[model samples]
Target chain A: MLLYCKDLTKKFGEITAVNRLSFDVKAQEIFGIAGPNGAGKTTLYNLITGVYKGIGEINFDGSEINNLDPHRICHKGIARTFQIPQLATSLSAYHNIKIAAHFGNEKNRVDKKVIDDVIAFNGLRDKQGIVADKLSLIDKKLTMVAAAMATQPKMLMFDEPMAGLSPLEIRHLMDLFKKINEERGLTIVIIEHFMKVLTELADRLMILENGAKLCIGPPLEVTQDKRVIESYLGNCYAESK
Target chain B: MGHGGNLMKIKKDLGVLLAVYGLLALLPIFFHNNMSLMNILIISLIWAVVAGSWDLIMGFAGIFTFGQIAFLVIGGYSSVIFCKLFGISPWFGFLIGGIVAGGAGILVGLPCLKLKGAYVALVTFAVHMILEPFLKSDIGRAIGTGGAQGILTVPPLKIGSYVYNAMEPTPWFYTLLIISFIAFFIIYKVVHSMWGYSFIALRDSELFAQSVGVNAFKYKLIVFGISAALTGMIGGVYANYVGMLSTRILGLDLFLILMVMLVLGGMGRFPGALLGAFITMFISESLRYFDTYRLIIFGLLVMVLVIKMPQGIIGLIFPLGKAGIIERTILHFREKKAKKAEMIT
Candidate 1:
């Protein structure tokens, strides 16, 4: 397993956000997670990336990474994008990528070429000089993803990357994700709501109902699980299909 | 790549700064006989060092500090007390003062930097409040620290056989100018380095910067320590220059004045500290004839400047690709010229 979470649990005051969740992701695998609203999907990503500390052990690539800082976790080869794009909004798109490159590169030297390449890969060549705050929502998301890629992470996590994107934009992102996984050999974990998109991309899928796992299997099998259908998919979703 | 172009721009900016420094170097020669004018310039230069140090930690690193004046007090008393009690040379006092102040900085900064934003400011403020009373206490008086009255006379800076005195203000002026320039230059290099970039990155977004591997606490401690040392070194020099040590050096008024200079010049810009210190000091001195009403006028001026031109004097000259009064005036002239051209057409 490239990443393992063993009985990870998180509670905020009186509420349990993540309840004893255990999972394993193989090297270069595309793992997808789907759940209804307030299902603790984002909270799980927070624990893995070291943004929030949970009760159980989180091992990444053979090392126990539960105690690491966010930057240390990133240096250890896990990078993630926020649910709402977080960037140095006052800086130019090119500069944002440069900062990430400086921090992400294992070596002390910063390769300007890597920065330029990431900008081009994100199709932000024209908007490179513009400040991040002025960029459209789609462009902001693209810049953020490009910055995360600059970190050279072996494992990349996305939190609802398709939330506000149009259908055409979503298709473009799907193609990009495919290229990133197949060509770059990066392990990806995506928390998304659109079931059709997850069925097309993810090899294995998990369904979470509140903070607990409902089912985990191949995408087709998990989607058709009786408990998931009744609790999450609902009678209307079942009847509409 | 546009690397060469960026290099050229840096070289050009360096040349401009060098030209400004060169003009300032020639100032002593022109004011050799004018004691009052030369005195004002020397005081302004001292302030340039202190304000520039403040700008380093607060402006560049985004560490809010109010204990800078405490460093100044530590520097002043350490140097003066050493020279008076131990018969140490004022020259050696400079080094001792800086080291002690820097040590105090580490002592304060290490624990305080763990607290962010207003909390950091409050800790530094506490340092100042504590130092002020300590300097005025019976323990301080027993040691001949002079308390509120301050040290009346101290040895002047001497080179080989010659002592610089009031009669020879020229040497004092040149000495101060050189020291201030060196201090400002060191600050400029730090502000442009990779460490400086990390400081800015953390300032922009702490969480985002941390995710990218910038250690916020370590950088804050480093900035605070270095800035305190610089301010302390200048404080030692100011003490020897005036030939006195006083608690007023750590007073709230001096702190306010230094802050005003930094704000009037522009924050975060290296040259802004120098410009702000000199211009504000010069204006304040020139208005001294106003006596009682001078402070009121100064307050009004600062209020207007803060509201209308928050970026300071440097912002007026170079507005970061934004328009200024000069740019606006030029555009106005161009518009008039275009109207005339339209009539002809």
Candidate 2:
């Protein structure tokens, strides 16, 4: 396993955001996580990326990496994209990617070639000169993805990468995710709301309810689980099929 | 977009910097006989460094600090003290003063790391507020701050046998010109480097910057120190040029005047603060005939300008693309001439 979370738990005042969630992600696998609002999917990503300090241990690539700073976690070969695209709005797309390539790694020297390749890989070549604030929503999301990739991470996490995307853009992004996994041999853990996208793209899926695991298995079997259907998928989803 | 494009931008920016400074350098050749004008020019150069440093941290780095004048005061006091007690040359005192102020900046920046927005501003401003009392207390007197009277006998900067003093404005003017030019050049380089990118990233969103592996706290603290050091060094120079220091230098009036420079220069724009400093000094000096009403008129002018040209003089002169006021006016006239020629034809 490239990522091993053992009984991770986080609480905020009266509410527990993530409760004793244990999961393992194999290297180079596309792992999918689906949960309703307040289900702690993003909170889990935060815990792993060290945006928040949570109880229990998170081991990545054989080293314990719980409660580290976000930058240090990034330097340890993990990068993530936000639910809302966060970018230096006044800067060009190329400059945005250059920031990650310059600081994300441990090396003192930054390779311009790597930044350019990531920009091209994400198909942001034409839009590279345009400032981020002027880019379309899809292009902004692509710029964020390109920045994350430029970090040269072994594992990448996506928080609702398809939230505002149209069906055609969603398809394009899904293909991009698959290419990133297959061509780059990088582990991906995606938190998404679209069950169809998860079923089609993810090798395995984990469903959470109220910050606790509902079920975990292959996407086909987990979608068939009764608990996932009742609490998450709901009767409407079950009946639609 | 690419290395080539970035290189071209750097070259163009450097060209502008050279043009501006070159014009200013030639001023002494014409106005060397006018001692009052030369004094105004020298003072403007000093404030230019202070205002530019403030812009670096506040505008570019997105740190809303009100302690810039406080840093200048610390540098002034420290340099004078070092020169008096330790018997060091005023030249060496400038370096010492910068080191001390930079240290103070880091010390203050530590508590500010966890703070956001107004809280950071409040904490830094508190430093500014507390400085007056500290310099007036017994500890200040014991440390040769001269108590409430302030430092009276600041040593003049000397080069071998030649001394730089107020009576001879020529040497002081040229000396400060070189110093201010170097200071602005450093700021320009920083604004165009990786450090500049990181600052903009953190300023926009600290969370995103951290996710991308930029340590926000480290960068903020470093910028605070750098800005303070530059301001402090210039403060030392100002002390020697004026040949004295006092708590009056910590007055709110001067603080607000410095702020007007930033506001009129277009915050976050490099070399804008430089232009703002010179223009503000000229206007303030020109209004000296109005007596006490000068400040009121100055304040009113700043308000009107701020409302009318929110981007300041530089923004008015060279906005993004070719739509600046001057450009538009020129284009309008050209179009009128073209129509007139067509009618004649």
Q: Which candidate is the best by lDDT?
A: 2
Q: Would you list the C-alpha lDDT of every candidate in the order shown? A: 0.81, 0.90
Error of 1 at A182 (Å): 2.2
TM-score of 1: 0.86
Per residue, candidate 1 scores C-alpha lDDT tens digits across A1-241 of 8999989898999999899999899999899999998888998988888778889989999999996778888888888877787776655676667777887755645788888888888888888777677788888888878888888888989899998999999998888888889988999999999887898999899898778888998988987788988878877766666
Model 2 over residues B1-345: C-alpha lDDT tens digits?
A: 443555655686688778889999999999999999999999999999999999999988898999999999999899889989899998889888899999999899999988988999999999999999999999999999989999888887889899877789999998999999999999999988989889888888787889989988789998999999999999899899999999898987778778888888878877888989989899888888998887787687778877987778778877643477767999999999999999999
The whole-model C-alpha lDDT of candidate 2 against the native structure comes to 0.90
Off by over 4 Å in 1: A34-37, A105-107, A129-136, A163-169, A193-197, A225-241, B1-16, B80-92, B138-153, B286-307, B321-345
Error of 2 at A151 (Å): 0.9
What is the C-alpha lDDT profile of model 1 across B190-231, one tens digit per residue? 866656666766776666666665566777778877888888
Candidate topping DockQ: 2
- Give the clashing residue pairs of candidate 1, or none: none
